[model samples]
Target: MILHLVSSPPQINLDLTDCVSNSESDATLQHNCLHVTGSIDKETDSRQFISYCMNEYSPKWNIQSNSRERKFTFVELYKHNITSRHLYLWSAPMDVAERYQFYLDQLSISNEASMATQLFYNCTPPRFGPICQYAFDDYRPDHLSLNEIIHDFYLHGYEPTTLTCYVHLQCDRGPAPACLDWSEICDGKVDCLDGGRDEEHCWQLEANECADDQYRCVNGQCIPYTFFRDNTAIPDCLDGSDEYFESKDKRANCKIAESVFECEDLTCTIGHRSWASPLTSSCAQSRSDLLIKAMFLHKPNSVLDECWSAFLCIIHGSNPSDTICGDFCVGQTFNHERKTVRSSYGIKIEF
Candidate 1:
C-alpha cells in the first residue's frame, strides 16, 4: 500500500503515528514503522510518494504504541535517481534464531535456562528480568525499548564485585598515575613522597609500649635497642625519626681519634659490627669491608644495592675483598633492588 502526500520542500514533516496505530496488528509497512521518513529536495519534485509493503513485509517492532506520537522530517538534496516513489517502506521478517542469539549476547547468557538461573540467583523479590537488571524508579507505566532496558541491566549487573584500593607513591597530589604498596604504610619515611600518606597517623604507633630490648622511634616504631643512636646516619626508621638529633653532615664531621673524616656522599661504619655507628667519609678512605657488612645488616635482601655500594667502594680504591660484588654487579645474578632505583618500565626497584 502506498500513502501519497504532497508538501513544499526545503523540508516536509511526516507523522506516521496515527497511520501505524490505525493499521492492522499483523500488517507491517516495509519501512520500519518506528522511523518512517525520507529526504527529498524542492529541486527534485514537490510531490513525494511514500510506499508501504503490507503482508509481504515482516514486522520488526518489539514495542507497542500507547498513543505515543512518531514524527520525522525529510530534508536534503535528492541524491538518488528519480523513481516511482520518493521513499519505499518495506517490512522484514524477524529471524527468531538470530534475535535469540543477540539477546543471549546482550544478557551474557548461553541460553534461556542459564538466564533463568542467573536471574534467580542475582535478583530478589519484585525484581524480575534477565540478569535481574531492573530497578524500581517509582511504579509507573512508561514506554521503553527492550534494547534500552537490557543496556541498563547490563550496566548494573556486570559491575565489578571485587573492591580494590590503589596506592600512589607520590608526596604531592594532583593525579596519582601510580600505585602504592601496603607494606610501605607506617614503615617510617613518607612513602607517598608527594602526599606522605604512609606517614599519616604515625603518632598512633607511639602509644604502644616498647620492650626493654626495643628502642622506640619518634614515629612509634620500635627497633633493636642497639640500633638506637648507632652512629650511622641512615635511620632504621623509614621516617628518619631516629636521626633527628644529628644530620648526616653533622655526623660526618665527627673526629675519630683526632683524625677528621669528611664524607662527600656515602656514610660508612668504622668496625665490622652491624650495629656500629656510621661515620661519613670518602669511599676510598672508609673501610670497604666494614661498609659491606653494615649494608648487609641494613638491607639483607637488597643484594643489588649491596653490590652497587660495594662497586662505589671499589671505584674509590677500596677492595670489596670478595667476588660476590662482581657476581652480582656484573649480571651474574638477576636479582633487583628496587628501593634505590626504578626500572625503565617505572617499576620501583628497592635495593
Candidate 2:
C-alpha cells in the first residue's frame, strides 16, 4: 500500500518508496534513512491541503462535501450568527497564516485566542462569489522561485486588488463612484441616475424579421406593422421610428401615442394640446427643451386651445414671459399636433 506521510510544515513534500526486508542468521540488516523528494503540483497540493484540514481540523471544519468535491468553505469567522461571505486570494501557507493574523488583528479574536480556526474558503455561492483563483501548475519552493510562482498565479487569475461591481461587469460606468450591483443593471431603472448610463449598451439589435401581420419594433419586439398595405397609416412603434414621411410632406397616416397638436416647429415631434404642456419630458424623453422655454402667447378663450403662439422673441437673453415677448409674436402660429387614438395590441404570437 502507498502511504503518503504528510510533513508537519506543508511547504515540504516527501514520497517514501520502500521494500520489505529482514535480517538472516549472523547477518545484521543496516538501513539508512531514505530521502524522497516531491514537487508541489497545484492539483495535488489542493488534495493535500484538503487532507490536512480534514485530518487536523476535523469537527471544526464541518465539511459536507465528498472526496470528489475538493472544495469546502468555513463560515462564522467574525460575527456571531450574522450572515456574511468572503472571497480571498492567497499564494502560500504563509499567506494563509497572514490571513489568520488579520482575523486576530481585526479583533475577530483576541491575542489570547485559541489556536482554532473558525472559517475558510469552500464550495458555496454556486460559483465563486468574489474570488482569486490561481491555475498555476506547481508552486514548489525547491523547483520554482516565489516571483515565478506569483507570476503564474497572476497569469492564471489573480487581481491586484478588489474589483468593483461595474468593473466586474465591465460596464462603462457605475451608478456611483465605486458601487456596482449586477441586479441593478439593465432592469429598466436608472440606478446610476446619470441619464440611464448604467442601462446603456445592455442590449442590442440581433436580428429583424417578422411573420405576416407582425410589425417588428426597433427594440426587436415583433408586433403588427401594418394592417393594410398602401393605406395612410402611422406606425405603432413606440419611438415612432417606423413611421416615414412619403413625398417630403412630412405627413403620414400614423398611430400616435396620443391625440395631440403638432408644434409650429416642424422639426419638433412633441405635440401638446396640454397633457404635456406642463411637463417637459415624457416616457420616451422626446420633449424639446427649447420649445418648453419658447415664447408662448396664450390664445385665451380659444376653441380647444386651438393654437399657442411660440413667437420668436427679439429681446436678447429674455424669456417668453418677458413683458416685450408678445411684441414679436404678432403673426406666429403654432399648429395643434394631430394624431389618431392609440391602437390596442393588434397582433398575437403563434406560440
Candidate 3:
C-alpha cells in the first residue's frame, strides 16, 4: 500500500480502497484503504496554498524527470463551481510498478506545466496584437528573433514575446525612432521616418568661442560670449562682445593712458633717455599750459602749483635727468640749489 497526501486549503479528503480475497475456500474479503488522518482548518484557504506552491516549489519542478512513480499534481477546490484557489502535491505510490507507470505518463505529457505557471503567475495579459504587446512603454520586440525570445524566457524567467512582437510591428510600420537610438539619430541632425528631424535637431558650440567674447555657431549650435579670466587689460573677445568698446582710447568712457611707448623701436639708452627727457618735457609743457590757462581763468596760484607739480611727478620720473647722466653720476641726483645753479649757468647737468 502507498500513501499519497494532497495538502491544500478548503481541504479535500480522498480515500483509496483495494479489496483482496484472503482465503478462496471461505471467500473471505480483506480491505486495505488510505484515509485523511489529519483534520484541516477551513480558514487555511486554497489561495494561500497556491501562492506558497508557486513561490516555493515552482523552480524545482521546472526540470525534466525520467521517473514514472514520482509525479506532481495540482488541484483547485471549488465552491459553487468557482475555483477558489489551487493546491499542489508530490506523490509516489509504494507499489512501485503502478507508481512508475503513472508518473512516466505525466512527465511525458506535462513537463513545463509547473514552470509555466511560475513564469506567468504575476504577468499581465497582453492587450494588443502580435506587434503591439510589450511589458514596458519604451520596450519593443521587432528586432528580437524567436530564438531570442526563448533565450530571454529561459534566462530571465519572463515572457518577452509580446514586447518583441510590438517592436517588430513598429519597425515594419516605421514608427518613431525608439528612445534608445535618439543619440545616433539626433546627432546634430534630424533622422526620423516622419520627416520630423527638424524638430529634434540642435547645435552646441564649444567653450573657446564664449571665452573670446564672441557668439558663434558650432555643430549647428549657437554659443554666446563669456569671460574666461577677470581683470584683463585687453578685451578677450576680438568681437568686443565680452567687454564692450567705448571711445577709441577708452573703454566704457573711462580714460585710458595712451600706449605711446612701444618696446620694439626703442634703443636701450635712447629708450631710458626718452622716458626722462622728452616724455618729461612733453608732460611739463602740458602741465604749464594747463596752469597758465587756469590762472588766466582766475584760478588761485596755490592750487595751480600743487596740481601742476603733482601731474608732472606722475608722467615724468621723480629725477628726470638720471637717464642721461654720465657713468659716474648714472644714478645720482642734485640738490635743489645745485639744480638751480646748473640752470642759471646754462649747463647740461644730469642727475
Candidate 4:
C-alpha cells in the first residue's frame, strides 16, 4: 500500500469499461467491504480511508472509459455531491483490508505535510487489478498532496468551502474562514461578515435589466461602470472589493471617521469596513456593532435581544429574514415625528 509517486509519477492507464460496468452492482470490492480483513477495523478507520480513495485517490484517473467510468473518480467525493459511500471502497482484495489499514498507518506517522514519503509511492491493491484498465493516462502525482493532504486549512480565515470568490472575504469577521457558497449571494441576508462583499455584483448573475452605461453589483444597484472593473479611478461597485487589485495604493491609506470600532469580542479598524459607504443610505448607519458573533451558529446577521439602535427595523418587529440591515427593514415607519401617531382607523390582526 505504499505510493512511490516521487521519482516518477504513477501510470493511471486503466480501462475498466467492461469490468466495472455497473458501479454499484458490479462492485465486487463493495460486497467484500462488509467482510473486513487485515488489522483495520471497518467501524473506525474505514471512513477516512474511504474518503481518501473516493476523494483523494480517484480524481487522479484520466476518465475516458465510459459514462460509468467517469462516475467513480474520487473527485466527485471532494465536492460532497454524491451519497453512495462504500461501493468500491476497498484498497486491496475484496477479502482483505490490509492496504487500507496501511493507508491509515501512514497517516498516523505524521501530520499531512511530514508523512513518510513511502506513502506517496504507487502500490495497487488487489481489487485494483480489475479497474486498473479503467485508469487511462499517466497518473499525475498529487505532489502537493492536495488529494491526500487534509483540506481544513481554513483558507483566509473562512471555513473554506471551495472559495470561488477569495478577495471578497478578506477576514472582516475574524480568524475562522467563512465559506462563500455562490448560492448564498443575493439570497437576501448578508451571510458574509465582510461589509457587503458577498452581495456585491449579485445582479449580474440575474436576467439583464441594467442600463447600458452602468454596471450592477449583487445588491441590484446600478453604477457608472459596465463590468466589475473598468479601470475607473474609484470602484463603481459599492463593495470596494471590485477595485481591490486595481487600486492598491489608495486602499493602503483609507480614511474613515473613527478609523476604528469594536463589536462585542471583535475589534475592527476602518480597514475592516473597506466596503462600507458612510454617505449612502444603505450603508450610512453601518456600525461596528453590525459584525455579529459567529459563535451564534444560527446564521450570519442573527439578531441579539439588545437593539443596536431604535432606527433598526427589528426594534419595530420587522425581520423579513432572520437578520437584515436596519435601514433596509425600516422603510418608512408608521410612527410620525418620532412620536406615536394616533389614528381613527383601528384594525386588529391575529398572529
Candidate 5:
C-alpha cells in the first residue's frame, strides 16, 4: 500500500493504526480505510482519482482548511451509487515520496519519449500497453516499494525483454528473425528460411542415440516419441521410416507404435518382410484372409494407410478412417516452423 504520488503535492502523513476508532463497531471499517490513498496512486489514469474514491468510498467525509479554521464536512460523493461502501486512504513515507518526485521530474525531461512514457502516460512499472491501460492482476503487489520498482526499470528497461529462440535452436540468420523449437531442430526437417540452420548439424543426430522422449528415424532423425506410428500418411522421419508399415527396415530396428498389435504366431505369417505382418487366425479369429489381402494385395503408395485401416479392422472390427486414423493422407511434408506439435494428439506413448 506504499504510494508514490507522481505529482508534487504536500500530503499529510498519518499512520493507519492511529486512525482506528475506540468503538468496536467502527474499528474494522476505519482500519480498512488505512490503505486506499495508495490505491488511487497505483492506477495509471489520474482522472480516476475522484471517480474511484466516490465509487469506492461512497459515505465520505471532507476535511478542509478555511483561513485558519479546521472544518469537517460530510458529503454524498456518489449520489446514484450508495451500495459501494469500501474506501481507504494511506500515506507514503517522506523518503519514498521525495524519491518519486525526483525521478518523475528527471524522466519528464529525457530525450527519448519511451524513457518517460511510464511517468508521462501515468502507468506504473510492469504495467504496459497503450496509455499504460493493461496490466496483469499480480503485476502490482501491496508490499512492493517505489524504489525497488525504479531499480527494476534501470536494470531491465520498463518493458520485459523478449528472448529470441533462434540462437538456442541454432537457426540460420535471415532478413526476418526466425525462431525454432527444440523439437524442430534436427528432426529431419528444414525450418529456417535462410539456409536451413535447423538441419545443419543433423549429422550429430544420426550419430547419437535419441532421448527417452524422442524416436530415432532410420536416417537417425530424432522426432518426438509420439511421432512414431502416428497413423499419418505423411512420414515423420526424413526416410519415411515412421510410416513405413511392414517395411523390413522398420521392424529390423524394432521401432513400432504401442497401438500396433504384432502377431506372435509364425503359423499365420504370409510375408517375410519385417514390417509386413497381417493378423492371422492364430492371433485372432475374424477377417484373417481379408487382413492378409489388404496388407499384401495392393502396393499402396503410403504404407501408413493400408496397415492402419487393416489393423484397426482386425483389432476392433472398425475402419480406422471412421475412428482413429488422422485426416492427412496427402503425402505432404509439414512446415515445422509454423506448427509446433505436428501430431494431432501430442502425447508421449511410453512402451
Candidate 6:
C-alpha cells in the first residue's frame, strides 16, 4: 500500500498503476489514505477503479496497481473540492514527489499550458479597483474589448466631438449670393440699344370704310362705274362722270322710242291715219310701204327727201295735211301696183 498527502493550493492529477488485486488490504493498511487497483494500460478500465476509490474512501491521497506488471506502483490523489490554494502528498515504495515534480515539469513545457495561460489572462478583470460597479464593467481585452467599450460609452450618453466640428464648418461657409441681373435686357422690356427709336415697327391694313365695294380707289382716285366699262348706253353714274354725254343721250332717246312705239299689230296709227292698213293695201303692200317709210325716216336720201320731212313729222305726233299724204302715196305707187296684181290673181300675200 502507498500513502500520499494532497494539498489545496494547486490542483493535482492522479496516477493509477499499483494496488491492483490487494485493494482491500491496502485500504486497511493505509488508514487515512485511498486505495486504487487497476490495469493502468487501459485508462478507461482504470477510471472505474479510480471512481470506486473516490466514492468509497474519502481520503486525500491513494495508490494504484499495474495489472500487466503484477506490481503495485503509482499513487493517486482524491480531493472533494480542490481550489488553487490546495496541496497533496503521495506515499509509496519510490520517491513519488520526484516523480510528480518531473511530471509537472513536462506539463509546464506543453503547448496546452501556454494556451491556458493566455486564455486565463484574457478573461481576468481589469484593474479599475472600487470604481468597477457592474460585473463586466472593468473587463477589457485589447482591440476586441475596446469595441464593446466604445459601444457602451455611446449607450451611456457620450457624444463624440467630431460631429460638432462638422456642423461649425458648414455654417462658416455661409449662404451664396443672389445672381439676378436687373438690366432692361432681361427685365421683359424691348431695349433699343442699337440706336433705333423703337425696337420694331409694324404696318397694318386700312380701316373698314376704305374697303367699301361701291367706291373703289383706282390710282388714288375714286372712279364711278361708268368709267370702268366705258359704256355709253346711259349715264350709269348718277353724277354723269362719263365724258361722252351726247352719245349717251342719243342712245337713251332711241331706247325710249323703241319702248314706246314698238309695232304691236299689222296696222299702226300715225297721226290719225293707219300707216300699215290691210284694207286699202294688201298685207305685202302694207309691210313694204312701212319698211320704206321707216328707212327713209331713219336715213333720208334725195328720193326720200320730199316725204322724209312729213314722215318724221307724223312719227313725232305732228298732224299731216292732205298734200303730205298725196306725196307719200306717190312715193308708194309701185308697192300699190304689186298689191293690186296679187289681189286680182286670187293669191294670198304676206309681209
Which numbered prediction scores highest in TM-score against the true structure?
4
The runs of at least 3 residues in candidate 4 whose Cα sits more than 4 Å from the true structure, single-residue gaps closed, are 1-122, 126-177, 206-351
Could you tally the backbone clashes for each prediction? 29, 14, 12, 29, 5, 27
Error (Å) of candidate 3 at residue 18 is 46
Give candidate 2's total backbone clashes. 14
Over 4 Å off, model 6? 1-234, 245-249, 256-351
lDDT of 3 at 327: 21
The models' CA-based lDDT, in order, is 0.34, 0.30, 0.25, 0.31, 0.34, 0.26
Q: lDDT by residue for model 6 over 196-251, one digit each (tens)?
A: 22212211111213334434322122444434445433222222233233331232
Candidate 4, residues 1-351: lDDT per residue as tens digits?
122223222212122222222344332321211121111211322222221122123334564432222222223222333212222232223322233334345545744433122111123421133333323132334523222112212111222122222344442323233344343445444544557565677666565556887766544556666446643433445444344433333322222111111111111123334443221112222221122222222322333222222223423334544354433434534222232211111111111
Summarize candidate 3's per-residue lDDT along 55-144 as a digit string, tens digits.
122223333433323222221111112111211121111232233344345546776333211110111111111111222232234413
Off by over 4 Å in 2: 1-213, 225-233, 241-243, 246-286, 289-351
TM-score of each: 0.19, 0.19, 0.13, 0.20, 0.19, 0.11
Q: Candidate 2, residues 162-261: lDDT per residue as tens digits?
A: 2224334444322122233443454444444335565677565335667877876554556565532322223344333455533232222111212121
TM match of model 1 to true structure = 0.19
The residue-by-residue lDDT of candidate 5 on 4-66, one tens digit each, is 334222122212322335454452233221112212222322211111101123134343322
The residue-level lDDT of candidate 6 at 302 comes to 32
User: What RMSD value applies to candidate 1?
Assistant: 30.3
Error of 4 at 103 (Å): 32
Q: Show the lowest summed lDDT stretch of 10 residues, model 4.
A: 342-351
Q: Where is model 1 more than 4 Å wrong at Cα?
A: 1-173, 176-203, 244-351
lDDT at 329, model 4? 36
